[model samples]
Target: MEYSKKTRSSPRTLDLNHIENTLSIILSQVEEPLPTITEIAEQLKINRRVLSRHFPVLCHKIVTKRRHYMRMSHLAAIEQCCQEIKEAIVSLQQSGEYPSESRVCELISNPGYFRYQQVRLLYKQELQSTLSSL
Candidate 1:
């Protein structure tokens, strides 16, 4: 009696050029946030180590893009918060009330906006401007 051995097929090879093109496309999109290397690797059905080893530049770009996006998002939020605080101050003054921190917190969507130094500085500046104008 002769026994036959079953052979295992090798994993499919990845197209490095195709992966680079796909990564470029993913990075080029303005609306979507950049994904982490792990996330991208998972989406591509490849191991993160393999992806990083094959495309170090793309991995770096993704990290850089994510950081930039986060910074811009944070700035936008601070801008919105400052605008809300300004509006709230005006509204309070119009209604014959002082714009205290608690009052401003009550007026804005995020009560914790005051926790940020930028937001606090803006609040103080606006308050001073209002007082000086009086």
Candidate 2:
């Protein structure tokens, strides 16, 4: 956040670039392993209340963006897990092995419990569809 060591020419001089950079730093820290605003202000050598006063909009934006990003990340991970589970199920079926929950778990590395349930449901549906087509 402290972009430079040089003192500002005037205490009242509002450097928009400096403020923007500081806001960026603040937002970047909003993810997991977040630092407190007081710590951030101390690191930037500014008063916490003053920083909040100057960047209320940026603070709100950071909170919103962080929440959205976290949700997206979580959804992506869940989708990936589901895909992996499906692939594992197909592989097990091809190998003439039953795709039981334990077998599916063994086929995939560090499979999640909920994902395994989803995989079981998907495998059953696929088997039922295949049988109905026969």
Which candidate's lDDT is highest?
1
TM-score of each: 0.81, 0.56
Clashes of each: 0, 0
Local distance difference test, each candidate:
0.89, 0.68
- Alpha carbon lDDT at 76, candidate 1: 92
The per-residue C-alpha lDDT of model 2 at residue 117 equals 58
Error of 2 at 102 (Å): 1.7
**Model 2 per-residue lDDT tens digits across residues 43-99:** 777777776788878767766776677778776766676676678767877787866
- Across residues 2-112, which tens digit of lDDT does each residue of candidate 1 receive? 776867888889988888887888778786478888888888888999878988888888889998999898899989999999999999999989999999999999878
Candidate 2 lDDT for residue 43: 74
